[model samples]
Target: MSDASLHNVTHENEAQFGDYFALLKPRVMTLVVFTAFVGLLAAPVSVHPFVGFTAILFIALGGGASGALNMWYDADIDAVMRRTKKRPIPAGKVTADEAKAFGIALSGISVVMLGLATNWYAAGLLAFTIFFYVVIYTMWLKRWTPQNIVIGGAAGAFPPMIGWLAATGSMSIEAVLMFTLIFMWTPPHFWALALFMRNDYDDAEVPMLTVTHGRRATRNHILGYTVLLAVLAIATGFTSIGGIFYLTVAIVLNAQFLWGAIKIWRRDEDASEVDNFVVERKFFKLSLLYLFAHFGAILLEAGLTRYGIEVL
Candidate 1:
């Protein structure tokens, strides 16, 4: 159905609370919360438990606000894409204007509350993150270029840095490493999904790598980025955040990730269609575990270090 028609569809029931919450993209928010939590805890400085909780809460709210704003702007494309056709705005559960208002309100509340709970620097980062995602990524880049994910990925990478800043009120090598990890990881992850989802971007008119560059080039890009990502991930283990635990996780996961990328690079579309993009699908799923395990290892290292348990 056309976006206009989708928006005009009569609804039998009003949007429930869950519909509004769905505007926040809870799955994406989970990543924001986890990485931010890791960043906060991994910092050298300690924070009061209540303050830390509130800081994370406000950061999550800021992330949710960004998601809402993204949905507001992308509703048209969302309506066209099978993956997103069921989202609140596209599904006629919420109006674009309403999503925009909710986003703006949450943005203000989260930023101000974060400033009150922690420091203005952390709040400023959070504010910039929301603006970057909503304005820079969603508005300017998403439909404009194939390189969108590469550049726009920076917005997602800022959460851990914000968390680190919330704790220490300054940046560090560790924080930058965390940011870089996510930034480098985003393209290949989304590209793999694009490969499997196949025609979604084409239908939606989004200039994803798979749409513009073709699957062969997209696979090449994934392999190239995976190499770079593996280097960065392993190199991070040598930094202050690196310990025996993190190093082990990094080495093992990167090997699996790199091998997956290689398999993706070697396969043709015929093979992919034969197995229903099994390699691509597995790589996509592994990408999720790959990130969480890396961050989880860092968190564990921090915990062990706090008790003077040497992780070297």
Candidate 2:
């Protein structure tokens, strides 16, 4: 082959690999893996190290499968949305049929592997999570209602619970509390993004709150959810899974999050436009830190408890 032709082929091959990986939504998978890992470690039951590793791997695969299926189903909307226009399927780097097949394959493999590595209960939760994200949220709720994220958040919230179950093969209040923390945190987190990316949702014709309700109403909803989230998050710090370390982290983060939400609620659209949605963007970024820090603190508490180092 000619040198130029060989170079072109190499570039295309490299791009193809990256594009397929993109379909998995690796960034989202990071949260899945982290939360699941924390959940497993935080459980009172001990899991073998290798078993825990494989369990988390399978769980991450399940999350990635959900992302791929979501992209497959939502390719049309994704193509139209500024934020999602370059996703592999929408960018024409992968076919919808291929994505669908890839997702289904990953879903089955992840579920079966997790069941073998841990228990069928955790696998069942993983399967349900994939189904909820792909069929319920992506295909039905996302286009159908402005409350999509509220109900759909359960899919994401399942990872830690699944992790807990993988460790203990049962449920507990601590697992439920971890699940609720993410569940309550989801709406405001996405709403802050919607506040800044209203036009993207509008263009995609997705029924996000900012598009259905006015920005004012969206702001109100953010504050409302943030208040509830703060309450739940701080209260979780007192649970069996929580400690002085967790409670201290929760108090500081929730205070900052509530303050951010209040700022978002008080601002008008004009002020937002004047500053290019700076507050919304900051809150959105802060939301990312908020969850990670909370989980990290929980993981620390778990480690301390395991070592018989009382954090209280």
Candidate 3:
């Protein structure tokens, strides 16, 4: 082959490799893996260490696949959005077709391998999670309504459920509660980012809450969900798996979260003060830790219980 053709082949091969990693959506995969770990530990049953690691790895891969397919399908909007513009497909590191194909291939492998390694139910949940994220959220809900995040939040909340299924090969009320914590957490967490990242959505023409409903309305909605989130967070503590450590963390963190929400709610969005953005940003930042800490506490409880210690 000519040098030009040789270069083209090399470029495609290199791009394909990048696209595969991109399909795993590394950052989001971290959260998925972490929560899945927490859920597995919190379960009444346990698996062998190696088997647990493999389950978490496959769940992480499935999450990444969903994210990749989302980016693949949403490449146009991603190209327009400042935050997303640097993503593999939109940045020219990978073509949309390559991304889509990469995402599809990994999605299939992750689901099937999870079934082989664990259970068909776990694999089925993984498949549905991928479908919900790529098709329901990225394709349909994203542009169709301002309530997108509220509804789309479900996509981000399935990891722990999958993990629980991996352990028990079935669902339980406690597992569902684990799912609920993240599910309810998604709206407020994402809406706060939407609060500050309005410009990106505006530029990309993505119908995010801040852009579609106006920032004031978005702020109200954020506060509303924050209340909902707080209720769920506190209620989760009273459930089967939560202990004193988890309950304590939940109460304190939810208090701080509620205070932040109230601050956002009372702020006048029309005012030109940076305070509005600062509080929302702080809350958004805290929301990240809020989740990580909650899951961490759950894992802590599991650890204590395993040692013949009780924190209830």
* lDDT of each residue in 1-312, candidate 3, tens digit only: 798877675454456565568656888989999999988888888799988898899999889988888988888998888888878877787878877887898899999988998899999999999999999998999988877887888888899999999999989998988888888888888888887776888887878878877878877887888888888888887887888998999999999999998888888765525555788889999999999999999898889888889543
Top candidate by lDDT: 1
Across 141-230, the per-residue lDDT of candidate 2 in tens digits comes to 999999999999999999999999999999999999999999999999999999988789999888899889888999999999999999
What order do you get sorting by TM-score, best first?
1, 2, 3
In model 3, the clashing pairs are 24-64
Best-to-worst order by lDDT is: 1, 2, 3
After superposition, which runs of candidate 2 have C-alpha atoms over 4 Å from their true positions?
1-15
TM-score of each: 0.96, 0.95, 0.94
Between candidates 1 and 3, the one scoring higher on lDDT is: 1
Candidate 1 lDDT at 151 equals 94
lDDT of 1 by residue, 20-105 (tens): 99999999999999999999999998999999999999999999999999999999999999999999998888999999999999
